[model samples]
Target: MGWLIFVWALTACTENPVDHDIRPPTTLEGEWLVTAINDEPLTTANGQAGSWLGFSAGAEVVRWEPGCAQLMFLYTVDSDDFRADAIRYNVPYDKPIFVPSKFMPPPCAIGWPPRLEEAMEAMSLARKIELTQSGSVLLSGEGRSITVRPR
Candidate 1:
């Protein structure tokens, strides 16, 4: 009876199995300037400003500013996982060209900047967020990737 009681006490004091599936929080709030895509450096062309991304904490939204117009995306971040859905362009209605008319659809309906489209595609496909040693953030998915630096 004494040996049986000792064995039961030891089993009761044993710890449960540890859970290794927990992930670390990914810090991705604030503005970030696009620096590279797929390991290639990005540059401003024809005197045009480069692209950028803005993230607001607890907002679940991300804004992509690519010189001409801003594209807003509905996004979710879970630990190191990131996913974005293309919503719509934040076009200014003050501009007559941007306003939808019977003759012309909205500017977004026509087309978007090539760079902006590329960035948006990459973001939408992004599945992982990695922090670089150089203080840059990398979003990668499949064969595509986007690198950004805090502004």
Candidate 2:
């Protein structure tokens, strides 16, 4: 009886094998700096030029500032599915919305940065978020993708 009980206890105490095939979805609840656009590497110069995204999981909001303007989006995520709707701000045309009042150039002078335009277009088209093996986040859709890394 003692031997049988010891055998039973040993079997019961054995650890279950971990399932390496399954993994929890990656989270998108922190600040991320843009690293690439459509597979093209974004240089430090271009990244510094302004291209970053921050997500607030609690608030369900994502904020992106791309050089000339600040943009906000209300977002939702389920597993790998992700969606974002731009939050429009009613700006009174009388005020200057450009950053750094002194060094405003062509695009900024016009109140629209070309990079911002491209980013907005890509974001609007994005419908999925994927985690790369390298730990970067890829937001992609309609053949366009934006890769970002944790800040």
TM-score for each candidate, following the candidate numbering: 0.58, 0.58
lDDT accuracy of residue 149 in candidate 1: 74
lDDT of 2 by residue, 54-100 (tens): 32333476666543444566777776777767665553334333233
State candidate 1's TM-score. Answer: 0.58
* RMSD of candidates 1 onward, in order: 14.9, 14.6
In model 1, which range of ten residues has the least summed lDDT?
15-24
Candidate 2 residue pairs that clash: none
After TM-score superposition, the amount by which residue 137's alpha carbon in candidate 1 deviates from its true location, in angstroms, is 0.6
Report how far residue 52 has shifted in candidate 2, in Å: 6.9
| Model 1 ranges off by over 4 Å | 1-25, 46-58, 66-70, 88-114
Among these predictions, the greatest lDDT belongs to: 1
Instruction: Output the lDDT of residue 10, model 1.
Output: 83
